[model samples]
Target chain A: MEIISFASAVAGLGILGIIFGTGLAYASVKFAVEEDPKKIEIDEALPGANCGACGFAGCSSYAEAVAKGEEGIDSCPVGGEELIEKIADIMGVAASSSDEKKTAKVLCQGGNQETFNKAEYQGVPSCQAASMVDNFKSCQYGCLGFGDCAAVCDFDAIVMNDNGLPEIDPDKCAECGVCVTECPRSLIEIVSSNEDVITNCKSALKGKEVKVVCEKGCFGCTICAKKCPVDAIEMEDNLPVVDTEGCIGCGVCVKNCPTDAFVEVDF
Target chain B: MQELFLLFMAASITNNFVLMQFLGICPFLGVSKEVPTAFSMGLATTFVMVTSAVVTWLVETVILVPLGIEYLQYIAFILVISSFVQLTELFVKKVSPPLYKALGIFLPLITTNCAILGLALLISMEGYGFIQSAVFGLGAGVGFTIAIVLMAGIRERLEFADVPKPLKGAPITLLVAGIMALAFTGLAM
Candidate 1:
């Protein structure tokens, strides 16, 4: 009786399995979705970082959008030129020549010694929260040193130095712009990684006013502008802007800045 | 009619799958971060639950009870639930690409949700009729949706709140879930 019952149990389960398995096999083919083959190809060509640099949620979504002709071919900043070319080939379109390799550059040089705090902030150690209150630091436009940029970076590119300033590693940075957006004072900028000249200060305060707040503050003295041999520096809104296109990357401006506001980024 | 109502009530509220019974806490916590995503997860789980209930009931009545192989119910129920989830996933993918993208990995995750297997087991154990089992499954899904969506709403608000440092993130989420569980217990009275 036991042997017969066990055999029946096995037979019943096997029949049930076979029925469901066939049903599923048929359903899979019947319900198969036709997807663009180019989307998968383009997705493979992408860096798959899912950094949201292209305003899409991830590389796959961006690939789907590109495959559908909804987004431009060169939308991904981290993909650089090669991946863009590969994606363009998959999409059968001419790749744009405007793709530039960029890196996040911290525009502030003021650290613990160069900058002083007006009040000791004891609340959440976020730059956004710290900057909400007035006079957290004497300098209104300097790195708050709360490491908000470091916190937002998924690539581990930004690190808080011992001097309470974010130091961005150019090699590790994907140029996704998360740190650039996270800075409360807008002290980080995405610049051409090949370009060496960067204005290390973002202070809009005039010469004497900047000296009182932070020692390394750009005083808008126009000294770097005057010293530029290629006429690459221009004073805009009391700040010297480096014309990266014209700038020959000579260290002349770096030497001429009295407050050391102009800096030459090392590759 | 009364029996059906009581079954629905028991599945949905008095024995709620998420808050009261705590059967499928993985997706309840994982997908409950966003309201829309949580709602989608709830709907997908509901669809799977009801379908599993019907199919399992059929299997129990037609195969298991007649053969007196009631002991094979657990393994059979799992096999049926997983296969059904797979089939539903394929159907959804074919019908709506946008939904397929939005649901992402959570759709396949419904296979492992113990709440589904528990529902199938419960229906068989109670000797519920086909319609009653279906209603119970639907009620359980609705109950799960309500709990998860409510949790999502609270978590969204908590984003702006100045929660204490030690009790931030998962700690605070768990505390809220515990409090919600306590409040749900009030429904029993």
Candidate 2:
């Protein structure tokens, strides 16, 4: 009697498994939905970070949009140009040539070597925290040097050097624009990799006031603005703003700036 | 009718799955980030719970009781619940792509949700008849929905409030969950 009951239990459970398994198998085939082969290929080629840097919910959704020709291949900043080429090859279309590979630029040169300290900030070591406090730097508009941008970079592209300024590695940067918003002083800008001349100062103070705080501050000298061959450099609120469209990739502004405010970035 | 009403009231409020019993806390916290998503998850869970309850009850009465193989109840209940979830996923994908998209990963995730399993176990333990088991399942699902939707509404408002840096994100969410649990205790009275 005991042997018969044990055999029945095994048979019963086995039958249950087989029944459910076969039923599910039939249902899966009956309810199968068709998906684009190109979308799957595109999704596989993508970085799959699903960072939402492409304005889509995730990598797969972005792939669907790209497959259907709704969004451009260059929309994914995290994937950069190489992924665009791969995606374009899958879609059998030429990638957009006008979209340049971009990188972030730290617009301030107010490192520890160049600037003076107003007070020793003993509060939070974060830039946001230091900014909320009295802001220890003499130049209020300078980089807080608390490495907030460095901390926020998902790609580990930005590093805080001994000089206390974030050194952005151009090759590693995907230009996701995370660091641009992370800075408390808004001292970071996304610029074209090939573009060179950059005003590395953000202080609105006059030359004398700027000289009192930072050694490399762009104190409204306007020399680069005046000397630009195409008039691309403009002095706005004591800082040089480069009109990217109008400017050529010449080192003329770099050659003229007295305080070394303009830097020639090597792309 | 009164006994059924009492059972439902007791299951939904006094013996709540998420708050009182703490059975499906994962979705209660995870999917409760937005109201629409939480409500959809709630509805999906409810549908699965009610259906699985009926099926599992039939399996217990028709097979396990007669065979006296009651020890295999857990394994049998799990098999039925997971297969049903798979079938529902396929049917939903074919019939309503929008809802499938909205539910997203949470639809398949319902297979692992212990609340459904707990409902099945409780039904068998309490020896509820077919109609009582269905009522209990429905009530449990409704309780889960109310808890999650209420949490989603609170979290949406929390986004704008001035939260301390350390207490942001998960910390604040847990604090809110604790307070909500405390408030639900009043419903027991």
Candidate 3:
């Protein structure tokens, strides 16, 4: 329109524009990295939970593993066997199904009914701390009942009961072990889901001393161990240990406990 | 070189698109729950940001200035940004279909990402030369990407965190953002 002052503009900025744009275009082309598309797909096929149960840091690394053909099939523990099987089908690899059906169970049954507190705990009542000095309660191996495990469960698998104890919902728990790591007292343990009987009491004290402390406390009495017909129960550190395979869910041990410590959970 | 480096750092941290400028908070909060979604959104925004900056600069310098239609900046920028996003969407679809799908519906949603518009406005307002403006836009995009991805990582951990009931949802996120802002203070110095 104004004689198209193009010559003047080119004189002012055309060379600079050309130089910069070309430099950028070159950089964009030169620095481009070829990324595999399947890496993303494999990652999407993953449960997207990022539960960190697969030994990898998160899902992205798991996706990288799936793409690289390095790691074996079944890695994501939270995704479970079904997800691993699907991933194996996608990657055209053999599915390594780990049949370990484990669920987190609280070892301590010393609720408000059983335990007495030496001192009132205030501020971040972690089980680890309760285990240090004067325990929040009298029993050393009892649940601090601070609900730390309830706090870390991604699924609503845990609810703190009225007695300051966390009850784990076995169906909702994926056994990611986040709660296991989060618990300070180490009272939470993973046992086979099929295991109907486990010693809720982890204390090693014996006889009347343990009975005086808590209503649900187990004294290291070998009566349950000695009276077992299948040799499943054994006295270890004064506490009766039930071998999971040998435990046929028989209530013989429950019937024999003098302190009502070894109550049958399923029976 | 110092100007370029300082511009890069300033755009990335001192004037972050997500946390500082609060430019792309929609995608920052929305798509940041998962690393994959957050990453895809960041990458797509980066792509859109760089493209719009280049085209808008060209339009502003070549056509608008020459034609004395500088008043048409907001309209011109919007039109160019929309077309550029559409083209980028098509390009991503053709070039990287999986990423396109991964980007999914968020691609279209990014058309509304104000960070792109903000970059266009800032570049035009600052009167940066084409390369400087493009660099600024890229820096803003990278800054946005960094913010959202870090947010995603934190949110993943937060899913298992024992945050209080009163601090759930936006309250906790705001607290996290405040902490992140405090963390960013180190970079500002």
Rank by TM-score, descending?
1, 2, 3
Better of 1 and 3 by lDDT: 1
Q: TM-score of chain A, model 2?
A: 0.69
CA displacement after TM-score superposition, residue B106 of candidate 1 (Å): 4.5
Among these predicted structures, which one has the highest DockQ?
A: 1
**Residue pairs with clashing backbones, model 2:** none
Task: Identify the runs in model 3 with alpha carbons over 4 angstroms from their true place.
Answer: A1-38, A42-101, A119-123, A263-267, B1-25, B28-52, B59-114, B117-189
Report how far off residue B25 is in candidate 1 (Å): 1.9
Q: What fraction of the real A-B contacts shows up in model 1?
A: 0.39
lDDT of 3: 0.74
Per-residue lDDT tens digits for candidate 3, residues A141-238, read 78888787897787889999998889988778877799888887778887774775678788888767777777888888688888888989988887
Please, what is the whole-model Cα lDDT of each candidate in the order they appear?
A: 0.83, 0.85, 0.74
Instruction: Give the TM-score between model 3's chain B and the true chain B.
Output: 0.92
Output the better candidate (2/3) by TM-score.
2
Assign candidate 2 its CAPRI class: incorrect
The TM-score values for the models, in the order shown, are: 0.70, 0.65, 0.55
The window of 10 residues in a row where model 1 chain A has the poorest summed lDDT is: A49-58
- The candidate maximizing TM-score is 1
lDDT (Cα) of model 2: 0.85
Worst 10 residues of 1 chain B by lDDT: B101-110
So what's the TM-score on candidate 1? 0.70
